[model samples]
Target: MDSQIRSVLPKTDFNRRSFVVTSIAAGFALAVLPVGAATITTDTTGLVAGEVKIPVKGGEIPAYRALPVNGGNNLPVVLIVHEIFGVHEHIQDLCRRYAKLGYYAIAPDLYARQGDVKKLTSIQDIVTKVVSKTPDEQVLLDLDATVAYLAGKANTDKLAVTGFCWGGRIVWLYAAHNPKVKAAGAWYGRLVGDTDPNHPENPIDIASKLKVPVLGLYGGKDQGIPLASIEQMRRVLKEAGNPSEIVVYSQAEHGFNADYRPSYNPEAAKDAQQKLLAWFKKYGVA
Candidate 1:
């Protein structure tokens, strides 16, 4: 059912790149006023940073692509899945950050087919309209399409995926769904959640079936994801003989990696970013 659902409808709306491209990375997203209050902003100088259209099943979809200035040779690819807030500003910066590390980073606006989340005022409204309606099957296919696009541009031999918040959950789902990824780093994604027709499964539910080694970074004090549940997921993965691992920052809360949000933790965020780099390298994605 999961595989068949998306094969039929390959939705693509890549032409709508309302977000302008900037060579200077400072203050890219104007909507985010007083930027860097909590979220970290990455500069895009000396980088091929701009919006590019990825050819999905139906049509082209707009997405932010970034790579090092001298990344002419075939470079490793890293798919940066955006958070629930959608691919507004911070997620694009993340792609730039990965590009600085010499990895071809691409973050597709997966919610483009449904609607634009940037126009929404409240996070709840974005969640209700965009996040909830997005099917896991579609997300995986979209990521695959992005990978295929990158493959044409550079060396996608070593593929890696990283996501934050809502994207964190997708990290697990994508790792389980695609056998091509070398590694995945999930940032504070929910392990357990209610199931419905629109959303059929959660990360915890599929822990035993994961083929790729996943490194989960969580916050101990996260208000949404409890510590108990993370522990349960760890147990499930270990029992299933899965090589994946989970790491929780004891003093951090949710959005620790989000330097733009109030919940951002500088110490934990730095450490986690290092961990992500190491995990990717250890698994040969770097």
Candidate 2:
């Protein structure tokens, strides 16, 4: 198969709601494994952690949902957005970690309708075959469906969102789209990108329109996302009088929170997690 994928379908004919990634993938992505011992795997004891179907417009997509078994319906909801690699073990384990902390955490496989990037070998191939084919409008609709599925049980008013890498950009997009969101944490998502029909706006473009507070965690040394772009986003938020903020860890590189990667920075990840929880708590999402 040609890894250099052209546009898979016409923009008008693409209906993300009609398609779904039905299976919750197992283990780490083939491209990233062996994930090694550094990756954190939170056990499901005292929690319900597994696949659940979230019904969309025409079908259902599989998502990994984790929440305390004993916690009642009042728990805060946290949407876990996966990296470009998709919702594999590390993303599932992160959901479990949040569940242990008393939040109902769910990581929906955002690329379900597109090809699975986990099966692809290289980052560029994965992006071309899967990520590039996914549309921002589709992502927001699927996420809205996920949230609506938990409407009666989860506290939407206290809703928060967090994402890693590709998902980080989504966190910002969701915050701008959903008025119910209280807080969000974006981890190393690209701050700027070219405008296309699939991805019409980057985080920088939406910063002024953010409906909720977002805490952006970025690496000063990240080669993919430049500090200049981050600074530009900060200036936009400041000018808009938005409460959103961006923090740059001087010693960290991209994917610092991904313990499965060589780019993981323990100090930055830990500190970022602490800041994330605190930001959520302060904004009523905790």
lDDT winner: 2
Clashing pairs in 2: none
After superposing all C-alphas onto the true structure, candidate 1 shows an RMSD in angstroms of: 5.5
- lDDT (Cα, tens digit) per residue for candidate 1, span 132-210: 6666776788898898888668787789999988889889999989998999999988888776554578899889999
User: Who wins the TM-score comparison?
Assistant: 2
TM-score of each: 0.88, 0.94
> Stretches of candidate 2 above 4 Å error?
1-20
The alpha-carbon lDDT assigned to residue 155 of candidate 1 equals: 81
The residue pairs that clash in candidate 1, if any, are 14-60, 14-61, 14-62, 38-259, 38-260, 39-259, 39-260, 40-259
Predicted candidate 2 versus true structure: per-residue lDDT over 53-157, tens digit per residue: 888766788899999999888899999999988888899999999999999999888888877777887877887777777888888998999999888877777
